[model samples]
Target: MTDVRSELVADPVGEPREVAPTTRDVTGLDELVVRCTACPRLVAWREEVARVKRAAFRAETYWGRPVPGFGPPDAALAVVGLAPAAHGANRTGRMFTGDRSGDVLYRAMYDVGLASQPAVTGPGDGMRLHGARITAPVRCAPPANKPTPAERDTCRPWMARELALLRPTLRVVLALGGFGWQAVLPVLDEEVWQVPRPRPKFGHRAHAVLPATDGGPDLHLLGSYHVSQQNTFTGKLTPAMLREVLHQAKDLAGLS
Candidate 1:
């Protein structure tokens, strides 16, 4: 377990594409992702948020580095999110942990039998995903939670490599928002599966079947409104709505 970060300090901007392709497994990929500094804006923003400290989290230390995906390597279902929340995953160092959005998302996942608990307080709270994995297109939190298209493209290699490594058992991808949906398509089309000629549109409950290019089972892509506070508080994405989508994803992934 060498400190890969040391190897990356020399050329932070080109590390993702350079390091991602060489990772042979999810564990290795996660290690590399946590060390990425490919986007200068993202790196600075994530670290600044960690330093400022939210009022309630002031006493606690923040995990300012890029957050990596969380779950078993052999997961059958993959959950793709936009990116780590400045005060959420960026604080806890785990996707969807220590945040309201995670509370909503995990509740639905628990109800659908994909999660071991209904809430995740932080990284070591014993929460776990069964036959599922959670990740994001961008590894670091961005200013205003909106990553520029260039930043998104720069971060694409990480997600692409992650999904490529998961191709053996991954059956269904549950995109948590339009951004996640758009981010995942090119990865599937160019790296793992054969996307349809006319790419599928993004909408809650939107579904698409991507034929596997390596002779594996077809991959199912399911879209859902992000479980962000804006959506949940406004009733745009209800708990029941998310549960329905999770249930559908589970069945499609052969987890149910």
Candidate 2:
């Protein structure tokens, strides 16, 4: 893949802008999530899917509920993903769980001491991310795994609000794919997350160092290929490779 460059310190919107984190909108995150009914269609779809899938899958009864955010209440690294999977995180109400994708990601995280366990079926599964949190570009499951730009926009405020809440402690943002990366870039200070690449380009192992408006280079951005099923099956990503990236990340931020 080619290296995609962004003109640092510009608004994430394709056009130049003064503000960032346009995706994040609300505050009081945990409470806000419980009351989130912003996407009525998604709510109905999940409930309906649960009803039908229940009878069809007696042994694996549906969780039949809204998805909840995961990880500790406070974290330094935020892992942003594309969206929930119909049978995976969306069903389990925890990001990346109940799916092969989580299999790879959690295992890798465990190896690096980021997680205490290698499994995350949902809340209270005894899984913990000692230093991180996981979020999605779009909170709800989209039809056919493709979020229309409008749907993506609707979810942006939720994400933006979350970022604002975390501004005090967050040191790094890890984007799992190209879409996740784009979704986050918009919310950052223009001087930090700039774009010079053409639209719709996916990058791997990319890192950006941002200078803070508060007079420090505190925030760091890192990109990685998602631990998607396709990537695992094709050996596109491996444990050693991911470990190297984590080491580099820790080094970049002087974590270790």
Predicted structure with the largest TM-score when compared to the true one: 1
Against the true structure, what is each candidate's TM-score? Answer: 0.94, 0.79
- Expressed as tens digits, the lDDT of each residue in 113-140 for candidate 1 is 9999888899779998999999999888
Model 2, 1-256: lDDT tens digits are 0121222212112210112234342233544453344455655565555555534345665553435456665567778888777777666778888788987888888877778997666667889887678888676666566777766766676666666566666778788888888888876643333344443245678887655676544777888888888877888887777776666655564455
Error of 2 at 66 (Å): 4.7
On the 0 to 100 scale, the lDDT of residue 20 in model 1 is: 90
Q: lDDT of all predictions, in order shown? A: 0.89, 0.65
